[model samples]
Target: MSAAVRYDEVEAGQEIPAVDYNVRRLNLVMYAGASGDFNQIHWNERFAKMVGLPDVIAHGMFTMAQAGRFVTDWAGDPGAVVDFGVRFSSMVVVPDDDQGATVTVSGVVEEKLEDKKVVIGLTARSGDARVLSKARAVVQLT
Candidate 1:
């Protein structure tokens, strides 16, 4: 954990440093094992293609978790996040390769609310496609 961000220090429209989260086939396998979500679409390219997906896609929840990590890491405390949500706009196709895919997460302070709370608008992208939409997080600052 790190020191909490003081509410007074953040201004609306301020941009947070973006992060690139890399996902590989092995990571998906580990996530599936831990999350108990053994869906073939996440690990089997053939099954994913059969289902009309371009290739094995990363779990939506896993992608969302990465976005959450982006915000929490910026806030310097997991507990700082009071609310968070996202709409899955597109699938994050993870090709079977050493590099797999990278989901870049970025955010900006949308607004400051009462009680030292701020609304952070988030964007998650893979290639040119927006993976997550209308993503937002309500974080409590010191």
Candidate 2:
């Protein structure tokens, strides 16, 4: 889908509506299968604890994908994203429960670059700790 946001319509510092993505144990299993990253830490609680993790942690790629989804959804086009990157700042602990965990993502238009491209600053948090940092996305608008 093409972005509804035109290059001239957006301004620096504009905020995109925040999104909360849910990550559950089942989702992790699905991701592991799809991505072929069958690391024990992501699915095995015993191995996770042995590795000094608090619990089964969500894969960094999973968290990054959620953040990327936030940006692409805002742009209204998955292909409109020209660049996207994030640093894993903290672990998202997922417990064996019905609710699992929630990752909240928010973004601000940091700058408007040349050629209808804009830089966006992103923040992703799970509980009280920031799970992703230095997250940024460059998107092209019509």
Candidate 3:
């Protein structure tokens, strides 16, 4: 494990390294099983199309969880996150192919909060669409 990030070391505008997260159909299936959110749009392309979606789209909560993972991993402790939220700006279309879809998540320290905390603004994009907007997390650091 890496060392914990000290609160004093980070500054506003500092960029966190980006990480690519893959979301395959199988992953969606697994998530659906685990989360008990078996929404047809998440795994059924035909049903999704019938519902007016271009294709089988990923769950918004799933995308939010991945974003949460990005922040918690960076903070080295999931419990460090005091606040996190996102708006589903766009759907992440997942094609039934070998390559699947990739969600690239990047973040920047946007503000230094009181009491050894920092507000990090996150950006998540898939294909040409911005999937998550108004995404931010408050993490407590040593």
Candidate 4:
């Protein structure tokens, strides 16, 4: 909840430090249960492979949430977020293993707007795949 940033203090082109998150089959299972998105591609490896996916993949919404978390966490107060959106660019393949998968999130301040709002550009990657594209958020700062 402590983003440690303010609109007045931020400047466009400033980079937010990247963060890495671990994703495992178990995590996907839990996400599936909580989201009621029991898509086989998200849990059943064989089914996912049968469908031509590399393996059981993380839910698109799940990956989107992760990016949302990255943006909101940087904005400090979640309520500061005025808008957010992204287009899914690639799948996050989750292999069943202790190593799991690593999702790295990074961003930069893209622009400043009226009403103490700042636009942030976000990026998310899992392995070599860019999981999200055109990810952006607008946040109102105090």
Candidate 5:
């Protein structure tokens, strides 16, 4: 485990180390089962293509969850997140192959709040597309 990062030690514009989240077919299937989102686009490639998608696409909520994980892991406490939200700007095309699609997430402190909290701006990209936009998280620290 890494050392805990205190709110006093963080600086604005400091880049959080990026993490790549792999989305494989089985992973998507598991996510679908877990979230009860059986959207055909997330599992059936033919159905996805018929809907004008390139291939099976991952769910927007799945992508959002991955981004949330990025922030919580960085904060070292999932409960530290006070508020979190994201806008799904693009789809994450998932191909049925060993090299699954990778969603890269990174964040930076944008502003420090009054009571030992900070606003974190997040960016998530996958397959030459910006998947999440206007993603931000407010975290409380000690």
Candidate 6:
């Protein structure tokens, strides 16, 4: 899909609606299988605590992907994102309950660049801690 955001229509400091993504034990299990990252800290609560984590934590890549989804979803196309990066600031502790955990992502148009590209600044939080930091995406808009 092509980007639905027109470069001429967006301005710096504009806000994008926040999106909350659910992270459950099942989802982590699936990601571990697909990504070949079978680290016990991601799915085994006991193991996670034994390893000094608060609880079973979500994979760093999984959290990053969710944040990236927020940007791609806003641009209306995954391919429109020419660059994306983030630093894992905190762990998303996933409990074994039905409610699991929530990762809330919010974004802003940080700057407009040449060639119809824009820099989008992103923040992702879970519980009281920010899960991702320095999250940004460079998107090519039509």
Q: RMSD of candidate 3 to the true fold?
A: 1.0
Worst 10 contiguous positions by lDDT, candidate 6: 1-10
How far residue 79's Cα lies from its native spot in candidate 6, in Å, is 0.2
Off by over 4 Å in 6: 1-3
Worst 10 residues of 1 by lDDT: 1-10
> Which ranges of candidate 4 are over 4 A from the true structure?
none
Number of backbone clashes in candidate 6: 0
Model 5 agreement with the true structure over 20-126: per-residue lDDT tens digits:
99999899999999999999999999999999999999999999999999988898888889999999999999999999799999999999898989999999999
Give lDDT for model 4: 0.90
TM-score of every model?
A: 0.96, 0.95, 0.96, 0.96, 0.96, 0.96
Error of 1 at 73 (Å): 0.2
Q: Candidates' lDDT values, in order?
A: 0.95, 0.94, 0.94, 0.90, 0.92, 0.95
Better of 4 and 6 by lDDT: 6
Which pairs of residues clash in candidate 5, taking residues 3 or more apart in a chain or in different chains? Answer: none
Residue 47 of model 2: what lDDT?
96
Clashes in model 4: which pairs? Answer: 3-76
Runs of candidate 1 exceeding 4 Å displacement: none
**Candidate 6 clashing pairs, residues 3+ apart or interchain:** none
* Candidate 6: C-alpha RMSD after superposition: 1.3
